[model samples]
Target: MNITFFIKEFHLRHPVIKEIKSALIKRGVNLDFVVLKETILDLQSLGHLKFASNSDLVVFKTTKYFAEHLAILMEDEGLRVINGSKSIRLNRDKILNNITLRKSGIKTPKTITFHSSEIKKISQKMFPMVIKPVVGGRARDVKLVSNKSELEKNEKNDDIVIGQKYIENDGLDRKLYVVDDKVFGIFKPSVLTPSDNSNAFKEFKVEEDLKEIALKCGEITNSKIYGVDVVLGEDGPYVIETNDFPGFRGIKNAGKIIADFLYFKKNEKR
Candidate 1:
C-alpha cells in the first residue's frame, strides 16, 4: 500500500520521524513524505497534496487544519486516515474531551469551562487552579494561577479556556500513550526541579494503573493513537488531559512503538 507521511517541515529531522520513515521503507510500503512548513502558503500546499493524493493511508503529524482538510479529500478518494478528522477534532479540544470522558464514565480532573468574561466567577470556585486553552495540547497555554488577581492579570486568548483545581501531588507526572485500545507505552517526564517549567515534558514509566487509564482513555477518545497525561492527586489518579496525535518529544522507546504500529503486522488493518 502506498503511504503518505505528512510531517511538519520543521520536525522532519526529528529522530522519531526518521526512524518511522526508514522502517516503513523496509516494509516495502510505497512511502512518500512531504515536509509541510508553517507559512501563509500552507493552505495551498495542503490543497496540492490533497489533489495529488494517491496513498492508501495518510499519516499526519501536525495541525488539525491540515488533517481535516486532507481527511475531506481522502474521504472522497476512499482512503483511510490513521487519526481521522473526527478523532482529531474531538480529542484536541479540552472542553469536548472532558464532555466525552464524562459521558463515557471515565474519571478526569474536575473542570469548569467558562467564557473569558466569567474568569472571575471561575476564580471563586477553585483555587490553585490550572487554566488552559480549550483547544490545546502538550501543556501549551497552560498556567497555574493561585488566585483571582493572577487570573485577571493574564491576557486571555481567543480560544475558550477551562479552569480546574490543581491537585497536589507527590510531584511526578505520567504520560501514557494508548493505541488501538491498548497501552502502547508510558513515560515519566524528566524534570530538573519541581518548579522548573521551561520544557513541557519530563521523561517518567508504565505504572499499571496509569497504563489501564491510558487504554480506557484511548477507547474513550476513539482515536487509534493518543497520549493521556495523568496526575496522582488527593482523590486518586486523575486524568490531566487527552492529546490527539501528541508529540513524542523526550520519551524513550516511543519511536519504536510508533514505527512498529505503522509498519508492523498489527497496523495492517489501516
Candidate 2:
C-alpha cells in the first residue's frame, strides 16, 4: 500500500512523523511527501496529481484551501482521501462546522457570521465575545471583543468572521484529538490570550462525557482525524469548535494507532 502525505512541510523532523513513517515501512507501505507550496500556485501540478500517483491513500496535512480542492480532484480520479472531501470542506469553515455540528444535535457555542461588509448591521450581542475568521485555523485572526472599539477595529473587508459567544474555562481550552474511533485531550492554557501565543500543552485524560461529545462530533463531520474544541461552562462541557488538523502532542501511541488503522483497512480492501 502506498500513502502520500501532502503537507506544507514534511513532519520528518518531528518524532511523531518518524514513528509513523517507521510503522508504515514495517507494514511494507510506501510513504511519500508532496509540498503543498509547490502545488498551490501551479494548477498544472494539481491537474496532473492523479495521473502521477498510484497511491492507495492521500493524507492531507496542507492548507484547508488546498486540501479541499485536491480532495475533489483526487477523488475524481477514483482515489480515496482520508477524512473525505466533504468533511474537509466542512471543517475548513467555522460557520459550516458550527452549523453542521449543531444540526447533528451536537452542542456548540452561539455564533453569528457575516462578511466584513455586514459589520455595520451587526448589533452588539454581548461583551467578551469571540471574533474568529470563518476560514481561519490555529487561532489565527481570532480576537476577544471586550468593547465596541475593539469590535469596530476588527473589520476586514476581505474575510468573513464569526462572532461567537465566548465560553470560559479559567483561561484554558480543552482540545480533544480524535483519530478514527479514539479520542485524547490536551489542555492548552492561555493559548488564546494575545500575550502568550505559545501552546503550553498538558495531557488531559478524556472523561466519558467528553468522549461522547467527541464521537458525536466525528460522526457529524465524517472525520477520521479531528480535533474538537470544548469549554467547560457553568452548566457543563460545551463544544465551541472543531478542526481537521491539530497538533497531536499529548497523544502517545497516536502514530502507531493511525498506522495500524491504515494497514488494517488496506488489508481488508485486498
**Which has the greatest lDDT?**
2
Each prediction's whole-model lDDT (CA): 0.68, 0.76
Q: Deviation in angstroms for 16 in model 1?
A: 0.7
Give TM-scores for every candidate, taking all chains together and pairing residue i with residue i: 0.82, 0.87
lDDT of 1 by residue, 124-189 (tens): 658887888877665667787778888778746555678888888765676676656556444354
Error of 2 at 25 (Å): 1.2
- State the number of backbone clashes in model 2: 0
* CA error at residue 248 for candidate 2, angstroms: 0.2
Clashing pairs in 1: 187-204, 188-203, 188-204, 188-205, 189-202, 189-203, 189-204, 190-202, 190-203
Which window of ten consecutive residues has the lowest lDDT sum in model 2?
190-199
